[model samples]
Target: IGLSFVPDLKLANSLYALGSCYNTIALIYTKLSDHLRALEFHHNALAISKRIDNRRSVAQSYNNIANIYQDLEDYDSAMVYYERSLALKTEGNDRAGMASTLNNMGELMLATNRLNEAEKFFLESLEIKSESGNRAGEVYTQNNLARLALLKKDFPGAEQYLDITERTAQELGLLDELRVNYELRIALLKELNRPADAFRYSELLMVVKDSLMNREKAEALAGIQIAYEVSERDRQIAFLEKEGELRKSQLALRNTLIVVSLIILGLVYLQFRREHRNKEQIKTLLREMYHRFKNNLQLLSSVLSLSARELTDEQALQAVRSSESRVNAMALIHRKLFERKDEARSINLRDYITELITYLIHAYGYHERGIQTDLSLEPVQVDIDKAIPLGLIINELISNAFKHAFIDHQSPCLTVGSKLEEKATLNIEIRDNGVGMRPPAERRGESFGLKLVNMLMNELRGKYEVSTQSGTRYVLIIPL
Candidate 1:
C-alpha cells in the first residue's frame, strides 16, 4: 500500500508518510535478522526522506542502517552510520532518539570490552532518559550499567543496578526486558556462589524465554518468507529504475559542474598570483623602512658626536657621548634586521654584544688605555623589544667600568659572558678586574648610569645583582 501511494504522492507530507512506512518495514526486517532486505528498504526510505527534506526520518534511516551493520558485526561501518545518525538527531533536538543512540553506542563499547567508555555512555543515556520520563529507556540503561559493573568485578554495584532494572521491568510488565533481567540475575547469583538463587533465576529466565518465543512465533511465521521474497524482487526492480534516473540527472549536473569548476580554478589561480606579488612588495617595503631608519639613527649619532666636539664642559661632553652610544646600539639592531634574510624580529645576542663591545672600547679609547677585553658569549637570540634595553644596560655597565673601575690600575680587564640557565632563561655576567664598588652608605648618591640600568632591567622584566668582592661583577637574568 505504501509503494502504491509513492507513485500518486506529489506533496512532501505524503512522501514523508511513504518514507515512514518503508522505515517501519526496514525495522521489521532488521528485527527478523534479514539485514540485506532491511538495507534495501532503509535505502529507499532514506532516498524519499532526503527528497522531502524530512530530517527526523533521515536520522531514523541512518540509525536503522547502523543497527544492521552492528548486528552484522561490521563495527567500523556501524560507527560511521551511528555518528551520522547522532549528528542529525542532535541537530533536530530529538531527545528520545539521542538517548536510544547513546544506549546503542554503550552496547557497542561493552561488546568491545571498553567498560569505562561503555559506563560513560550508559550514564549519559540514563540521564537523558530519566529527564524525558522514559522509564523503559532507563531500565535498558540500568541493565547496561549492571553488565559493565559485572565485567569490572563490582558485584555489589552490579546487584544495585540489576535490582533497579528488574523492579522497573516487572512493574512495566516488559516481558522481553524481564527475561534479560532474570538472565543477569542468574549470572550475578552464580558469581556470588548462591547456586540455589542462580538456579531459581535460571528457571525464571527459561519461563520468560518460552513465553516470549510462543508469542512471537505465531506473528513471525505468518507468510513472512513469501512476503520477504516478493518485496526483495520489487525492491531490486525499483532500485534499478531509480539508478537509471539518477545517472541521467548526474550526467546533466556533471556538465554544469565542470564549467563552474574551471571558472573557479581560474579565479583561484589569479588570486594566488596577486597575493604572491603583494607579499613580495610588502617584504621589499619593510626592508626599505628598516634601511631608512638605520641611516637616520647613524645621522643622529654623527650630529651628537659633532656637538660633543664643540662642547666645553666635560659633563656635557660625557652626556653627548652617552647619547651617541645609545643611538648606535639602536642603529645596529635596525641594521641587523635589514641585513637578515629571514624575517625574524629577534637578533643574535652573541654577535650584537660582540660588535657593541668592540665599538664601545674604541669610543672610550679603552684599547689605547691598555684595557684587555675577553668575550665569552653563548649563541642566543633576543627579540628587538628586549634587546634594546639589554644593549643599553650592557653599555652603561661597560662604560662605567672602563671609566672609573680602571682609574688606579695599570692594566684593566673586562669580561662579558652569557649562558643559558635552566628554565629557558638567559644569564649574563660582566666582570672587571679593578677596584670594587663603594659601600652602600658611601654610594648613596643616585648614579645616572646605575639608575638607567635598573630602569632598563625593569622594562626587560628581569633582575640584576651587583657584587663588589675583589672586582665589580654584574649578573643579569632574563626569561626567553
Candidate 2:
C-alpha cells in the first residue's frame, strides 16, 4: 500500500499514513522477536518520516529501533538511538513520547544493573505518566520500581510500590502489568520472609502465566505452521532448482556455532560484571562500617572527656583521660581507613601518627607548658590488625611521657621518630628530654597504661627497649 502511493510524494498526509503503517508492522515484528525484520521496517519508516520532515513519526521510529536494539542486547546502539529519540521528542514537546522513551531507557538501565540511573529514569517517567493521566504507563513504571526495590532489598518500599501497581493495574484492566505486579509481589514476599504470602502470589503468578502463555502459544503455533508450510514449498523448489544441500547444511552449522559462541561470550561478560559490582558493593559497605565505627569511638571519647571534667580526684581524672586518649587513637586510625578509598585494611603511618601526636599534645596542655616536639615519621602502610595495637602503644607512651617525664622541667622536649629498618622491620622511637624515670627491671608494678602497652606489644609480637640515660627513650620494633 505504501509502495502504491510512492509516486505521489506531494501527498504528505498519505506519506505520513504510509510511514505509520510501516512503523506499526515494525512493532508487530518486534513483538514476534524478529528484530532484524523489525529494524528494517523501522528504518524504512524513519527514512520516509524524515523525507516528509515529520518529527513525531521520526521520533517514534527511533524509539522503536532503540527497543529492537535493546532486545538484541546491543546496549550501546540502543542508548544512541534512545538519545536521538528523546532529543527529537523534546524538541517537539511530545510529553507522551518522552515518557515512553524514558521508560524504555529505564528498562535498559535496569537490565544493565545500573540501579541508580534506572531509578532516576523510572521516577521521571512515572511523574510524566501521572501528569498526563497515563494510568497504564504509570502502572508499568510503578511495577518497575517495585522490582528495583526488591533488588535493593527494600522490602517495605517494594511492597508499597507493588500495592499501588496491583490496584491500578487491576482497575485499568492491564493484564500485562498485572502479571508483572504478581511476579514482583511474590519476590517481595519471599524477600520479606513471608513464605505463605509468597506461595499465594506464586499460585496467582502461575495462573496468569498459564493464561498469557496459552494465548501466546496459539498465536505462535499458527504463525509457525504458516511459516513452515511456506518454507517447505520454497525448500522443495530450491531442491529441484539447485543442488547445494551440503553447502547449505555447512552454512547453517556455521551460523549456529557463531550464535552459540556469541551467547557464551555474553554470559561471560555478564558474570564478570556481576563479580565487579559485588566487589564495589563490598568496598562501599566496608567504608561505611569504618565511618560508623570511627563516629562511635568519637562519641565514647567525648563521654570520657565529660566524665573526666567532673572527676575531682586527680587519679580518677587521669584514668578517664587515659581511656579517652586510647579511644581517640583508635578513632583516628578508623578515620584514615575511611578516607582511603582504595584499601580499607591498611593505613598510612605518616598522616596517622602525625594527627595522633597533635591530638595528644593539645589534650595534655603540653603546648601551654612550653613543651617542644620533634617528629620524624616514615611513610608506611600497616594492616589494621597491627596498626590499632601500635596506635594504642604510641598513645600510652606519649601520654606517659607528658604526665611523668615533663614534670618541673624548664625546657621539656618530646621527640618521636619512625623508620623502616631493612625491608620487613618497622622501628619507632619516643623520647622525652625531661626528668628520667626508673629502669623497667627496677619498677615494682605496671600502671594501667603500661599494662595496655605491654599487652598490645605482645599482640603485635614486637620487641621494645627503654633507655633512661638522657631523659626517657622507648624504641619499638615491629615486623611487617
C-alpha TM-score for every candidate: 0.47, 0.46
Give model 1's clash tally. 0
lDDT of 2 at 142: 91
Q: What tens digits encode model 2's per-residue C-alpha lDDT throughout 29-104?
A: 8878899998998998999899999888889889989989999999999999999999999999999999999999
Residue lDDT tens for model 1, 377-421: 988988665687788888889888877788879888999999989
Which candidate tops lDDT?
2
Model 2: colliding residue pairs: none
- Runs in model 2 deviating more than 4 A are 1-270, 439-444
RMSD list, candidates in order: 25.9, 23.2
